[model samples]
Target: MTPHPPTWIRVSECFLSLQGEGPAAGTPAHFVRLQGCDVGCHWCDSKYTWGKSGGREISIDDALDEVRSLGEAPMLVITGGEPLQHEGVYALLARSLGRWSRVEVETSGVEPPRMSHAHLFWNVSPKLPSVTPRWADTWAHARAWAQAPNATFKLVVGSERDRDDAVRLIAEHEVPAARVMLMPEGLTDDVVRAHAPIVVEACKRHGYRMSPRLHIWLWGPKRGV
Candidate 1:
């Protein structure tokens, strides 16, 4: 008999939605949103996931069963308020989605992810100081993975200072220009359009990719959208 794996994770929701950001934007995908976070970003859209006890605590098998019910998609996006909060999430992906799915993780880049043998595409968005407290250690971890081989570092620039900050972080982390993404910070359609042109121009000037927040445009920060 095989040993059963431990189940640990707070899941807010899961659904089929078009990829709303990064290299996979606009693509059809399955999303798994785990819960809990230590890093507090003021503008974090998913504040509902911050508490450990509020959301539904789900087993990996049950989560996979939900995914299975949806049939196959080209990719799966595992995200969270901080998905790495749960120890068992890594094994769950390895045992389940690793077989044929292209797995993508949208993270704040504060904690290192635990994944093995999956085509892991990491979209690492590090928080700005304006949104959270300054921690050299957390920033270090963000920098380390932000510059990892298979990861993309995205900085959400809301002001000129933010852009400059991202540039400095890139240098500090030794992240290549090719791997950097500059996304304007916006939570609404009007807000997105307002910031898009400026950030897009900045990306072109600095030779980085401009990541538009497609989820906001598609669903307007509505839950499960």
Candidate 2:
């Protein structure tokens, strides 16, 4: 008898929602939030997902069933505490690619993704110096993704210092300015508004595009949006 392919994936949560950040913002998508990350960004909105034990394991078939249940989402977004941290994500991404027209993976840029399907869009968000105990591994992953045809660099800018770090990273990795998105770092609409001008100025100064946190603006910082 042939052995069965692994059916399980470590997942934090799954829901259907609009793509909140990046160039794909406003596009309706199915979100598969995987569990665990060590990047430990100070302003991470998904703090609940930081621990592997905090998430439940579900069969890959069941996860795909949930995606199909979403009706006709334009894409499948595999996000996380950091999706690349899970080895099973490769299988999940591969399976999703067969069904969805587009598959987007949002990662912290700490580890290189194992799967590199043509349809996979890598949204690499590398943490700035403020994130603490920075990982040296982020550079290799960032460099690889920078060269990827379907990848974009979405840097979260909280201060002028963060903006400087972003510029350095973009230049070092040779990421295209057009493919780079500078997002204001905030969870609330008020905070976002306060930081918007600074981020917009940074974008203009550096020739990068500005990405707004649409989900937070529409629904605050609540879950399952």
List TM-score per model, in order: 0.90, 0.93
Residues 83-112, model 2: lDDT tens digits:
888868777877788788889999877876
**Which stretches of candidate 1 lie above 4 Å from their native place?**
1-5, 113-118, 134-137
Instruction: Report lDDT per candidate.
Output: 0.77, 0.84
TM-score for candidate 1, residues paired by index:
0.90
Positional deviation of residue 135's Cα in model 2 after best superposition, in angstroms: 4.9
RMSD of 1: 2.5
lDDT by residue (1-225, candidate 1, tens digit) is 986656756788888878888987888888889888877877778999888777787778788778657766788888887776667667766755554457887778777745544377888887766778843434667656754657888778887777777787777777788898888887898987887777887788879999878899878988875
Indicate the worst ten consecutive residues by lDDT in candidate 2: 131-140
Best by lDDT: 2
RMSD of 2: 2.1
The whole-model C-alpha lDDT of candidate 1 against the native structure comes to: 0.77
